[model samples]
Target: MTALTQNRHSPCIGICKLDESTGFCLGCGRSGDEIGAWASLDEAGKDAIWQLIPERLQALSVRVRLLPYAGGELLDWVGETIREGRGTWVAGAPGAVAEFPCHDRDATVTRGEDELTAAMPKARFRLKGSEKLRAFAFDGDGPVVLGLPKRRVALPMAEVVTPLGPDEAAIDPEFRDHELFDIGVARRASRFCVRTGDAELIAALRAAEGRHWTELMAKTGATIIEKSPHRVVETGLARIEVFAEIPPPGGTSPTGPHTHLLAEFLTTGEEIPAALGLPEYAAPIAIFYPGTPPA
Candidate 1:
């Protein structure tokens, strides 16, 4: 019932997610900081994770599967959608799409079978008589994200990438069973923290904002800049946001970090890197090139 529910045990299930400032997922049963601090927690400290589980499970009631598709299907993307090939999300745009790894390589959220494809650019995808979709590029055991590997322990694997779209919250009313893995969700700026300071770094960010933003999101206009307490890797002159949802290209604006863009990453966590150095202002971070630049 409360944090004191000892005998029955809290629903933590071993995954302890701390607040990002701490490198833990109060949700996933891991600290936002995965480095030294988490490694240092003793059993007693670890057992307290038992207390947070119930609160998190209550939140999972809204989890949905992130299904990947080669072309736009009857499905609507409730969270985010990645366009893999060169074509646009128009009538028939196909290269490879699986609700999961469709985004740029660095932005992969989960492992899926890339089973579908569009025959040509602007070729609307057809679920029937279409190319296959597999989550990974390789025939077997495709790619795995380096930092956060898919939890070795498998939970229920629901079939989301099938004919039906992710069940809408309005229609399904009951969705406690399906939960899209919130991998890197914390790294999102709105979902986590973003630090700013240092004239050059800030200026560079502002400049980026002024540029690609319009191209990233569908609409145009700048969003306010905000600073927060969670500091990921702050050394002398720089800190960083680990993840972000860059807007799509050519919606509005001058082209740069769109004010409405969602940026998420780690800060003030136990896993903070020591070899950290300031990010070079010379170019955009990985978010800029979610896929290979048009060459």
Candidate 2:
């Protein structure tokens, strides 16, 4: 039988240490009980456990290892790492495409004295110095090294101005009178897009977007609707509802579309925002602007 037809088995990667807090095996994300019962578990039970592993692994903290390479050695090590299938490569910049299961042919690394740059499709890294290079590993999927400047500064989130135009306003002359409509409007005008108080989820969304937004959505099994000016992305973890081509509150024209993220919980198929007991419009924890550098 081919690899695709082969039966599934254990996920152990040999680094079988258990996390104290979560009681899960660090390498395979299986609970101690799960591991002990794995051999006797039925196929359906195994499948159920496998379905939960991704979210469990995502919940764990990422582990980073600082390699000992310096100067020109950094460049050589990067090439060798990719060739050896160490991990996927992620460009340091926001909105940069990540190279998952990166192959040597799909990556190019070049160096000049103390600086280096690695280029992959739709992703590029420009490093001012190689002294501070490090590798990031997430859920054992990486030792992925990134080229970044020695000193980096955090940029503030840019303001998104979406004035309600006449056409949009005409949709509902009494929209302001409706609380739900006002909530949606306020969300669009707010600096942040994601509406959640969960710090962990916020951090995960930020890190995931920083590495690769599309990849994160795909990994989470998100359902995406790519219709212009009105796109929606819904996943088990979060939901993003976007409204684009908005104009000024009283204006008549439409402008380019912008995006925002909305977070809510679901059970079966029903939304349960009240489960968190958060206001209809909680303070945004994270905002995402596709094709634009994260703010």
Candidate 3:
């Protein structure tokens, strides 16, 4: 059969509900008119409509039922799909659907519904138990789609908070601790460091090597002092000397001095220490010498 013939099939994945705001079906991302006229439409017409489904899905808000599976169940499903070389794995519940492409040999999915919870080998998904809850995944190196279950009434697009870029991040002193500093003599001299015990961030840094590491560090608004054998960044206030260093066997970071390259900081330009308003004493900082201040 020709590719075009195969393309004639419907895109529906069983869930059938219209997003009132956009008048698009959540399952197939098709309008009522499009769905009704699908049979009458020519191949060209169908092609045109198919072209719009992705955009419609991106814009429309649809709700789906949650899969009542434990963390292990979900993880097992993901692992099986990957092992079987399934091009895509999809799960649906009532009015919702979640789908992802599975091809990586080393993708890892852990149990957690928190943001930046882990390195997320390829993609990270978080789910909370609530009828009105929406499960989403990190847009790392893969694509993830979740048809969130929301109230019957969907909010206007204008009300949604669009993410800001690194350049557009608001200047807030609250993120002061996230700042990097330069301090040390000899081998550590002129190096910058940001202390953090966040295992997720550490893992991400370790995974992002070479150009990926460089690009990730650039988001910190830090000056690139070095970028070859090891990456060194300067945030005017401090320097990152030990970026991407893994912790010891117990997962505890070194006591003296180290660097952190958190994915949250790279993507959102927000520092956890600053957002939590942690005190200087409790902040993630590793001074070279006791009582010695950062440069």
Candidate 4:
């Protein structure tokens, strides 16, 4: 059956604010340069950036949750009938403290929580086991908000924390079902541009050499830098390729021209055909890394 598809668009939220510390936008998780040049990039570039947003947001959310609580005060308004009793106090810097109401001229003076603890050097809010203070009120003061506000939108914990692993082709064969993985695979499968500049290696890879040349090259100290499956129309076939950059070994600074290390799968099409028996679930057509060519 003939297929019909519509054009794909970008994932820009427009609420762009670059966080200096993380170098990611608070809303879109894109670098400032990426945001500025979004319109000019091809589909591949846009897809690459889009696939990273969810992972970035998950990391940022975790970081925000673990930040120290800023110090707050207990005002005079929170007190009931005057009674000399101890109460718990919290802050990011200072540990927990036992605070007793000091009734002198019907006035209350606020001090850093750290002052009560000899070990603590700065004022901070701390909580004990199964204890959380959503809001704290002073005897004569307004309620001060504490800790990170609850996340309005819930994120899937599994997707947020779980990684796809080093080799996408072998990591989890079933990951495509996941939204994050699906988007990531779509990006890789759809990308048309490659980062490598070696034309010789590119031509060799395009030719589909019959023999597993990467294994023969590996004995010479070559290594695999990156490897992934290139879908049809992206790399011309459903192929798992090992991308490597080989620089001349010994006293060489990679300043001169070099060959790219590549290993193509034995089979072709939308899925890896099981007919070819190979180790590590892949057949190495060519292999190269940061070293001189073998023999």
lDDT of 3 by residue, 1-295 (tens): 1123322545555667888887888767788999999888887888778677655665653322122222334334334444444444332211111223334334343443421111123222222222222212211212223222222222222111111112111122332333222111111111222233334443433343332333444543332322211222222112222333344323553332233433333343322212222122111111111121111
State the lDDT at 179 in candidate 4.
Answer: 19
Per-residue alpha-carbon lDDT of model 2 for 1-295, expressed as tens digits? 1111123456554457899999887767789999999998876787678667766767775242222244456455554544454444322111211122233345465656764444444333333443433322232343233322223322233222122222221112332221111112112212222222234433444444433233444543132222122222221111223343323334442222233332221112212111211122222111111122222
User: Candidate 4 on 248-273: residue-level lDDT in tens?
Assistant: 44423222222222223211321211
Give the runs in model 3 whose Cα sits over 4 Å from its true position: 1-7, 62-295
Candidate 2 clashing pairs, residues 3+ apart or interchain: 164-248, 164-249
Task: State the local distance difference test value for candidate 3.
Answer: 0.33
C-alpha RMSD for every candidate: 21.4, 19.3, 19.5, 28.3
Give TM-scores for every candidate, taking all chains together and pairing residue i with residue i. 0.15, 0.28, 0.24, 0.20
Candidate 3 clashing pairs, residues 3+ apart or interchain: 63-95, 64-95, 64-96, 180-238, 181-238, 181-239, 192-239, 192-240, 192-241, 193-239
lDDT of each: 0.23, 0.36, 0.33, 0.27
State in Å the error of residue 288, model 4: 46
Residue 176, candidate 4: how far off, in angstroms?
41
Q: Number of clashing residue pairs in every model?
A: 70, 2, 10, 21
